[model samples]
Target: MTINRHCPTCRSRQDFRKLNDDEKAWVRAEGSRSYVDNLWRCTAVGCLTYFRIGRINDRGLLPEKFKKEPPADAERP
Candidate 1:
């Protein structure tokens, strides 16, 4: 399922989808809970940037959180 949310990369509100099982697992393996259930991906063509859905601190804007490859010790999703 997809929902509309603000995408910092797109610099506007865009369609977003939750991370799949494998993607969630990858986030878990990265050892960061910040992006576990809160991460979303922009669905715009040629713009698949991942971002955090929740806010951190007092900032009222959604922050983009790009995904990186899993660590060497971490299993690939």
Candidate 2:
């Protein structure tokens, strides 16, 4: 998912890459949520507006959360 938004400060485009839909507060199962990665900011500088790249997935599958790497100590076992 790509969230494209125009920054009024920089007049540049701020893009955000959406990863998946994860559960969150103020949002229900039927509600919409987006996870963004590789967030990009205006190179022009001065634009504080942050835009997340998000595209609605028409598929039936819901967005899954990103898994963090296991601890190195745990791997020793």
> What is the number of backbone collisions in each predicted candidate, taken in the order shown?
0, 7
Off by over 4 Å in 1: 56-77
RMSD of 2: 12.2
CA lDDT of every candidate = 0.61, 0.36
Best by TM-score: 1
Off by over 4 Å in 2: 1-5, 12-34, 54-77
Q: Tell me the tens digit of each residue's lDDT in model 1 across 39-62.
A: 776676556466566641211212
Query: What clash pairs does model 1 have?
Result: none
Candidates' RMSD to native: 10.1, 12.2
